[model samples]
Target: MTTSRPFADIDTWVFDLDNTLYPHHVNLWQQVDVRIGEFVGAFLKISAEEARVIQKDYYRRYGTTMRGMMTEHGVLADDYLAYVHQIDHSPLQPNPAMGAAIARLPGRKLILTNGSTDHADKVLQRLGISAHFEAVFDIIAAELEPKPAPRTYQKFLDLHQVDPTKAAMFEDLARNLVVPHQLGMTTVLVVPDGSKEVVREDWELEGRGAAHVDHVTDDLTGFLQGLSKAS
Candidate 1:
């Protein structure tokens, strides 16, 4: 919000799915995380506990656990994607305020996510905001590459014909904002509201004065509403 004429020049609004779109307290991702480990365990013929360690390690090393599996074990991406996304989406609900605020914003709005379009569609449809977005640029669209990767961001820009300077990206991961900020897009980090207990890594929540983040917000609905008010 401190940036000069915030949203004044932004013609493209980009948002990350998962925690960035829905509240972290919903804990929907927890089910996916568990399923991911289970898939890994089944694939490797290992215990669930051991597979989780590898899953976390791969996530840290490859920007995504699926990528690591592909690189190290020659696993098919579709196999992993299909398995990890089978969790129930019942935890999500429509946020009329958030949808209304987003609908009020001018220009094209898109979801840039590390997830598959199938997963993004489910989340958006569940939230009842599917009509508000122009499109979703997902991991498959990025050729299986995930965020925090510069080339993936470039591919997304090229695909959408988005000018970084005129775009704003909102994400839950601070690291994911690094590439967007470096590309000259205004980067916003969305954090948990603390109404529910959610565990996050120190780096994931650490943003404030970080050079990569231009803004931070806990209440996305309120934050977008405020932006609309000023505009």
Candidate 2:
């Protein structure tokens, strides 16, 4: 179903970086995941497989793996971030098409991500699209309040001085899109085909009376094309 909300009225577009900005098959995050598993293994004296399971459990329980480690294992956030993002980002090449799309998008644009500011900066720089966003709301800005949390969505709106009704949130994670919908923002789910790492939470799809997502597209290019036509 299409939304009655006019696309022309959207004054701000909040984008989720990382997986949303690029295809997960690129395996950029897999490198980071390998490092995370290594860290968990070395620090906790567990096998790599065990570490992976623990990381997943922590992410589910604490909204973020870092938060879980910090609270439960007393791991320092800075150290964890430094260790995990230490890999080479040479795999991420600039996407001129993505940059062009961002350039053509109307109104204010900002990046909202659960990653650290340093990581966000590096990723955007690697993509050669750092100039597109006006501001970046990183994990520090979220104050450890990760996505899927209503308070995190509220904090994003408050920090940007945005009217929730007039904003649009584009995220790869269906769960993260829920709170934005609840807060009256137009929600778009970017569902790229064959993205194995895209986590699916049944609650996001099965819950009754949930947030009414405005649109779903396989990639940013299609979404941008549709918006351009609508405009």
Candidate 3:
């Protein structure tokens, strides 16, 4: 059970936009997943099956498939971001309860995403929580670098003037929270609720008991609502 006391001192609430903010049953991110595969296939001029293999391989090696493409194939970040993020926001809807919970959190809210600002904005707006976040630190802001990278986390901190010890980070991927945990921020891993049939890899499901992860929750709204007011 999550209690309020542990988070009392945390003032800055940083959240990852995709799987963190909403539940997986919505299949909102699944759209992006399909788009990434399509983009990889078309861009690499390879078969869809081959693209899937390369996508997962690249994602495993690099924090993002885009980074892998950039490093190996000289793909432009702008084009890749534009192509992958052209997903439908129809699957997602306004979650007033989530917005209310987020609004209740003490201090400021920010989004730290490996995606573009446009994609983050679209997701936030579709979920009706765009107003709650003060700013979004996106891939462009981090110079195309993604999370799990120490330098990217440091750059976000420097750019936002955030105190890691006084902040909390909510992310879907446990590996993405490692850098934040190392930097003294409270790391919460948002896992899928398992209410839906979403395909996932074995590695994607790892890190549940990792030392760096401070908390794990399938219900983001409940977790946010349960937090005690920041001291």
Best by TM-score: 1
- The lDDT per prediction is 0.90, 0.79, 0.88
**Tens digit per residue, CA lDDT, model 3, 10-119:** 89999998878978678777787888999999998999999999999988889999999999999999999889988889888899999999999889899999999999
Ranking, lDDT, top scorer first = 1, 3, 2
RMSD of each: 1.3, 2.8, 1.9
- Give the Cα error of residue 98 in candidate 2, in Å: 1.8
Which 10 consecutive positions of candidate 3 have the poorest summed lDDT?
1-10
lDDT of 1 by residue, 25-55 (tens): 8988888888889989999999988998899
Candidate 1 Cα misplacement greater than 4 A, ranges: none
TM-score result, candidate 2: 0.89
Best of the candidates, lDDT: 1
lDDT of 2: 0.79
Give lDDT tens digits, candidate 2, residues 120-219.
8888999999998999998889887688778888888898899988888988677787788878888887764654554444433333223466777667
Candidate 3's C-alpha runs over 4 A off are: 1-5, 228-231
- For lDDT, candidate 2 versus 3, the one ahead is 3
What lDDT score goes with residue 124 in model 1?
Answer: 96
User: Could you tell me which 10 consecutive residues in candidate 1 have the lowest summed lDDT?
Assistant: 1-10
Each model's TM-score? 0.96, 0.89, 0.95
